[model samples]
Target: MERDRGRYVPGGRESAHQADYLELFFDLVLVFALNGLVNRIVPALTTDDLNVRWAALFQTVVLALPLLWLWTTTGHITSRFDPRRRLIQLVVLISALGLLIMGTSLPYAFSGRGLAFALPYVLLQAGRPLLFIFTLPVGDAVRALYLRSAIWFAGSAVLWIGGALTTEWRRVVLWTSAVAVDLIGARLNWPVRGLARLPASAWAVERGRHLPERYQQLLLIALGETVLALGISYTNEPATTETTIGLLTAYLTTVLLWRVYYHRSGEMLGEALDSVRGRNNLGRITGAAHIVMVFGIVATAIGYKLVQQHALDRPFPLWVVVILGGPALFLWGRIRLERVVFDRLSRRRVVAIVALAVLMVPLAFTSALVAAIAASVVLFGVAAADARRSAGRPPEAPAPPA
Candidate 1:
């Protein structure tokens, strides 16, 4: 494998690097962005106005999907290119700055900062790939892939910028349409009017560990957000018995989420990818799984904050939704990921998902604290099932096709 000047060269396993420090530095900004998202949605769950709450919830998804998409794009860049190169470093640093601006604008995205959010995002999404297109040799397959990607991003930019210039639901519709374009375009391989789809080899990951490591880092980042929110929420309040109990419940829930995540399947993604028969769709499946799990973690953080802020208050329906829904969503994502790794459905997670749904109605009448505990218990059961399955057996090797 000959090294290109700035592009990734497929190399021996020994030559491939682990995730670089700069990549981790970039993820710090993602932490702030995740926090902004959690903060953005908390108010919506607490509000009494049905229309306002529903609108804010829609806004939350509208805002969140793009941010997660941006992160996924960044991961692909590092996976496809040489992250240690100066040009790659510059792309990541600029992205961190863009994320910072996006995070700052989030609280006001629907009100006054739509452009503030849209501008940097558009520049990053549409511009970064254009940069890559010029950097690679004209005949390079990777360059061709990026060419298709840039076309899609450039087309979607119209809607993003248009949404930014508008107001209210108009903005939401345009922005949502823009995200659909970006996401669905990528899913379909970013087809253009005059171009054929890039061959599957064009999407091959040269460095196997890099993409999996980045995904794992993101999972930790999401879990880290939950820990930070729990700690901060606890420090700000009087440590009464109820608050203390709520803190413990939230902390346990966070641990259980982490536990359920890393059990056999999560720990074996790299092996699964290595063993998979085809690589083209593995990254896409894994990326979608992590996105859903991260969403769940962010929502869980918001729910715990609500518990800390109003521990004794009667749980609102929305609060209960957040409380149980987060873990349920996490389990749902985990089940998909398990199939990717093991080629098997996760009955335990399925049962947990159903259990959470059943508990939601009863939990709605209880305190947020009770709802939090029930969610944690459900997660614990999943983790326990994982432990039991692994007991007295050899470590689970990935069964994913090559």
Candidate 2:
């Protein structure tokens, strides 16, 4: 076994890493999973019942966090390990399968397929680390890290499986608590009373480009969801004038989302990671910011479906929320990303966010198409501002903490 060291896991972060083909394939699974998430929410938004609408909205957060966490954990694994190794490739493939199962079970998760969701999730969360524990050498820092993580997952498994057994709000409570445990445990380095926590070196990036590239791929996946929703909705019926314009509006919004994100901080993220001190902390912050942006993009995709289905019809308050709120959420996330990378917020993003919020007052009374177009206009302003800011200047460099 001593001879096998560095065969699976890298000996150190001695080289810059690029994303592997397997990692990209795993992200493709997320494309389907996120589309399912949007599909689940659209129906609830269309209904007149406020309770069901709000419940679906709550469900969005509940379901999305776990799926995103799976993706995040996978990214971390591939970042730290030699993803080309056969064993690590198996891990990525299995995670993709787990995500597919969870996505398929998502629409019915609160209903009959609760266990289907919980079981795969539990297996992935607990199983991955257990596999690594045996393979990694004794006294390896990563081995201890996995040991602590497995302990945390074991404690959460009870809640996840128990949540599947119960019905109604009980399941919701249990599952939500389970997710909280996983997230909080990771945030705290998966601590155990008797074991040593991860060393500071665990957070350092050997391949600085790898993790950030994975995150960028995630944001692109989210943007792709918006396009998929538009294409699917447009084809469901004839291309009427309203639907045509709605599709265009949604596309424009998607473009702006990509532009706003990548214009400065997003494009410079790799450099930011390479130059920043506390790379681990920055990585966590970067992950969180991308999560928020992805959620916003998902909401916007839901809004696109709503717009296409009822282009001329007056939107419900929740529909209005989806249309305007989505871009606002993305802006907020971009703001956080900006702070970490540039150490400052973009004035354009702040103004765009405020504009979206104020539009909600008028948008609530307008058609869904109108609300979507209005939201797109605000995003366009931000994009245009980005262009103007960078028109003659050189690209911005990351100003992350030393």
Candidate 3:
């Protein structure tokens, strides 16, 4: 396997080790897409009928997946290429503008404006690689990878745009096909004709920091939006006791969720990724795991808003999916990450997930505040147990490349 080596350039920051300004600015733009997604879902989800709420939530997830994947794939480009380059920065700007329009159209995406949402997605995902192919110099291996990726995105775009032009159930089927194709390409690393398999030498995180840092920034955005949802909930309604307790409970839950992952889980995964820099399988597992983790955070954000809106002591039955299921999904992701990173299963973590699942039936009858608080306590238990387990182990280093 190749080591941490790069070509030298005189008088350039190409060798600089941290994220640059243009990348940070681009990250800021993507959050508009995230905020727009939650804004659309929560109101639809809060309807009085159970079946309607379920349908709304189901559709919300479907719409949000492609948006998330678009941003993730864009991140892949910025992470791999030199965004500091003049041409690369221009492409990044163009993609961000397309995404902003897509974000604004989220509420109407499934209604009348499906094509509005679809076109920007197609342009951003399919056009990005096409832009790079012509601008990047010849004989570069990374450029060849760009060609392979463009092929994947172009094929997926056909399904995406076709789905957008349809309505109702057929739209769902076609969009699913598009997402499935994209996921399969990623899962298999888009192994088309003669592109070098990656984390190419350019994409490796030498200090084991860049890749995780980018993901962590997104995680921060997720957590910040959770807190924002709590604020929005509080503002929209009267500040009575139920509202106060619900907000407090959600605030605590967000903090614990942050502690559970960022405290130990993220650092360990970053180091593990560094260990197997050029090995795509380990990196894919870790990246896929974080995607699940982000979804859990997004789910929890919606639950917090619902918690505030419910009548006191009346059951918030959907708490089963959001309050309980969110943490469960996160722990599931964490367990997968740790198994690969530490080479051992954390039994307490697994037990905590099962316990949360068992508690869901009872939680469905409880007040939202009680439900949020209960899940928070359970996560604390898992984090505590993992801390104890770590006390007897060697201080972490990336597992040496096998």
Candidate 4:
């Protein structure tokens, strides 16, 4: 095959890059998909036996990994493709419909609905890149990148379909490996002998701006889930003093999450990511962190629902996982993202992560609602202290690293 060496010019710069409406609409599917996944696993958290509940939830999360990979990668696809075209918009809508079908399959994903999930997933992974390849004008670097991406997606789709054809532990083992391959391949830019690995930035100058915005928006949607879960849970039953307290604490937890990322710190991190001209490690880390961060938000949403049921009353051991584990995961992802982008540690976040971990031990003895409050309060302190400290400093203006 002759390569279009002259034809494949890199992306051109524009005044500004913002996520289009199609991108936002596409992200809406992921939010709902996560809700379905949570609905499947979280109810089991009420089980009195900690060991049983842990096993059940872990199994459910493992099953949910494919959908998370689907969500993240789909975002990457749209970020590269020109969503302005009617066909691209149609493709995105169809992808969203596929996700809805996948969401329906998630509750029984480890069992009878395996094919139900895998069929749509295989269709999206195999079909999406082809759509973009044909839609994009010939000679674009992004088109070439998608061509490389399609190869890996095709390889992963084989395992996905194979898993769906099997039963029991074999299905779980196969699908888990499939998700791992999908994630690893994307991270490596689907490296193969003879094909050059394009620096993530080479695909689009504007992508650095667009990709982080997409992730931040996804995180915002995940936070909104926490609020929605609290509202619906409270409305179905009569409110009590404890319920009110739980609601307030849940609301604060959501806000603290918002402040932690959306505040000045998030801007600083974005600039830092932009500064690194090549070797898109920031994009890779941001993509991976979004998974952990959003999963944590979903976990926290699950914890809030349980907290609503037993507000202010410590009743079960699994609440520790439902409550503390969410914040711990979110903080862990947050700290890692900062470490990569800013290359400077936030001692406050480090403390918050540590405190959340250690506090889990003592808070495990208390009510789920109490544990929820305790965890959020730790973040509250971190956000407040950081705000007070950064109030006087000028915004960071780091030069692009050589």
Instruction: Please write out the lDDT profile of model 3 over residues 32-80, one tens digit for every residue.
Output: 6777777787777667788777877777777778777876776666566
Ranking by lDDT: 2, 1, 4, 3
lDDT of 2 at 324: 93
Write candidate 4's Cα lDDT for 1-402 as tens digits: 122443322233242266788777777777778777667766777776777687677767776677777776666655654555455567778888888899888878877888889999888887877765765566556666777878888998888889988986788778778888877776667776776655443223244476677778888888876777778888875698888888899899999988887665455655766777663655666666777888788889888888888786675656786688888788778876676566667688888888888887788777887898898889899889878987889865643333
RMSD of 4: 3.6
Could you say which candidate leads in lDDT?
2
Instruction: Return the top candidate by TM-score.
Output: 2
Q: Whole-model lDDT, candidate 4?
A: 0.73
- 10 residues in a row with least lDDT, candidate 3: 1-10
Question: How many clashes would you count in candidate 4?
Answer: 2
Please, what is the whole-model Cα lDDT of each candidate in the order they appear? 0.85, 0.87, 0.72, 0.73
For model 2, how big is the CA root-mean-square deviation?
Answer: 1.9
| Model 2 pairs in collision | 13-206
* Model 2 quality (TM-score): 0.96
In candidate 1, list every pair of residues with a backbone clash: 276-401, 276-402, 277-401, 277-402, 278-402
**C-alpha displacement of 109 in model 1, angstroms?**
0.7
lDDT of 1 by residue, 102-126 (tens): 9999999987999989999999998
lDDT of 1 at 224: 94
Spell out the clash pairs found in candidate 4.
8-139, 314-367
